[model samples]
Target: MSESQNVIEIKDLDVRYGWGRHSVQVLHGVSLNVAAGCTVGVVGESGSGKSTLAKTLVGTLKPTRGTVMIDGVNVSSVRGADRLKLRRKVLQMIPQDPFSSLNPRHTIGQALAEALDPRHADVKKHRSVIAEWLERVKMPAEAMSRYPHEFSGGQRQRVAIARGLIPEPTVVIADEITSALDVSVQAEILSLIAGLRQELNLTMVFISHNLAVVRQVSDEVAVMYQGKVVEHSPTAELFNNPQHPYTQSLLRAVPGTPGFSIDPGITEHISHENRAIA
Candidate 1:
């Protein structure tokens, strides 16, 4: 996509844990572009730097090198007041676990009210807006009266989604948002996200290890392996004709895929590929 059409543009991203010889590189020259109102699925196994990329987008983890531009603002350059503004308006994230993020001491109403307007004293003033959001997420309006602990995992996830979108952010990064839920709940959550994405024309980066789930949600998919993006293509094209060795191995290892299964050999293949890349 062209620069004007892309809402998020990442270029040659590099992330490291330390300095000098002790430095452990987590991401190596990663680049991705997300068009406005589109979902980009980032699929990779553990340690593929999926979460790291999510963090970089969310500003929780700073990039060691390269540029991250969201809505024309450079993420690394924004600081202090600008940084807070960036978080509230430019980007927001739905975390992997909702229970931990929600406050146990506050009612769902207060939590959402805070999200709506952090300094608004009258929580009741946000009642209508919060109710509308709750309805949008297919939750009961009365759910506002209950505490986070009173909700199930799926219900909590619904609340989390509401909270993330309540701010009307420019971009939302969903990092393993369904990993903690059961299979049925995962389906429900994914469906809800799809509906919401259409309704809001949301620009999102969905990080997941499940290729099937990615295929259902994403218009485009980027396959990550060993901190690098090995392949990026339309969802259908990537699944049907993966060009990278790591990506092909990942597809073949999908459960019930004729003759392949995930095992030590998968890592061996990756190792060989890594050597070849190096």
Candidate 2:
């Protein structure tokens, strides 16, 4: 949480697609840090570059400008084996929809084995570790042989998590990982992630639009608006005294059930719909 303890650092990051006449920037000089062994949440509304940031961290997207530093190395600049090594050992991603993320043709064991392959000299040697990761993520040993479509959404997510964990990476970037599941399943997955973070001493970059869910998992919260972070605070502080107008509005947009009296003051500085982003 301190400047000297950063495990991941992004400074003046700008991500864009194409170039010249077709260039469209998604991240506007974004910057943040994740301290070692800490969970940092990047929260924002839809189309706010949350997904782009997550993808950049996990090596799926390259920034048009700036750097993504992990363990003091500029990850965005690496190519081929160097980049592959960094991602397999230092970074991993838990995608949003587990149902779609997993390969339908491959069994759970096969999918997990692929993730562990980078560590193993031979893919065949990773079988035992695959079983262990499945157990760690709360999946039954028998479920390893089943295909993704055979399991429920929550179960598939557990398998997806197992795949991500099999590599024993230091940083896990979860992109709305539990957004598609039921509330009960969401809680289960979140608890599993929290437990894993503690047990493994792992650092996590959790990206989501759900403020309540982000509040539950993150030690620090970064409220992003229009592709730039507007506020960064300790989770408790952000929840208690949100300073940014967009952050306040997002909290209000969360639906309340019957018998709940929502505070109307949270929206005083925010528009009915945020219009600041292109």
Candidate 3:
């Protein structure tokens, strides 16, 4: 994809955690791009480095090697105050666990207000804007006065989405955003996000392990395994004609699709070369 068209450009990104013998590199030269106004769904089983990639984009975790450019700012190289500025203006991350990411001590209004202007997230002063955002996420405007513990799991997730988006950042990284909710609530939240995404023309990297969910929200899809992208293609094409063994198996694992259930015997033979898919 052309740089001019892409809001996110991640090239040869290598990320490692810990040090010395204990160190583990989770991403290996993984590269991908997200076009402006499009949502790219990233799917992988546990330990696939999906969350790690989200952190890299949101500027919380820097790439040990290679580069990550978000909305023309190179997150890998920017540091200190500059890094904070990038996070504040260029991008935001909606973490998987709303309870953990949201401050239990802070009221809903205080949280959303702070997202807009951390120093001035004064609920009293920014009530109008915060209320508007809460309503935009299908939440009641009065929710601002409530606490995180007062809301249901689904509602908290909505608040989380509002918080991430109120900044009006150039791009968003939604990491396993709906994994914890029940299927019914998950659908409702997805519908809410879909409407919001179009209204905002949002550019996002939506991370999920559920193939069905990815298919529902993504314009394009990237399949990761053992910290590498095995296949990256348009949503329809990837589902119809998966090329990688892991990807093919993944499609089979989905309900209502042909070859629906994976054969247990082949689970051990899913391949380990970690080769990049063409």
Tens digit of lDDT per residue, candidate 2, span 1-278?
A: 47778989999999997879888899999989999999998888778899989888877889988999988888877889988888888888888888777878878877887788845434347667777888898787877778898888888888888888778887888898877776666767777787788889889999877776777789999988889999999999998888988778766663642212122322321222122211
TM-score computed on alpha carbons, candidate 1: 0.91
Worst 10 residues of 3 by lDDT: 269-278
TM-score of 2: 0.87
Residues 120-226, candidate 3, lDDT per residue (tens digit)? 77999989999899889889998988899999999999999999999999998899888788766776777777778889999999998877777778999999999
Candidates' lDDT values, in order?
Answer: 0.87, 0.80, 0.84
lDDT (C-alpha) at residue 197 in model 2: 82
**Residue-level error in angstroms, candidate 1, position 113:** 1.0
lDDT of 1 by residue, 84-185 (tens): 889987899998999999999989889889887877834689899999999999899999999999999999999999999999999999998987776667
- Tell me the spans in candidate 2 whose CA falls farther than 4 Å from its real position: 1-4, 118-124, 254-278
Sort the predicted structures by lDDT, highest score first. 1, 3, 2
Error of 1 at 131 (Å): 0.2
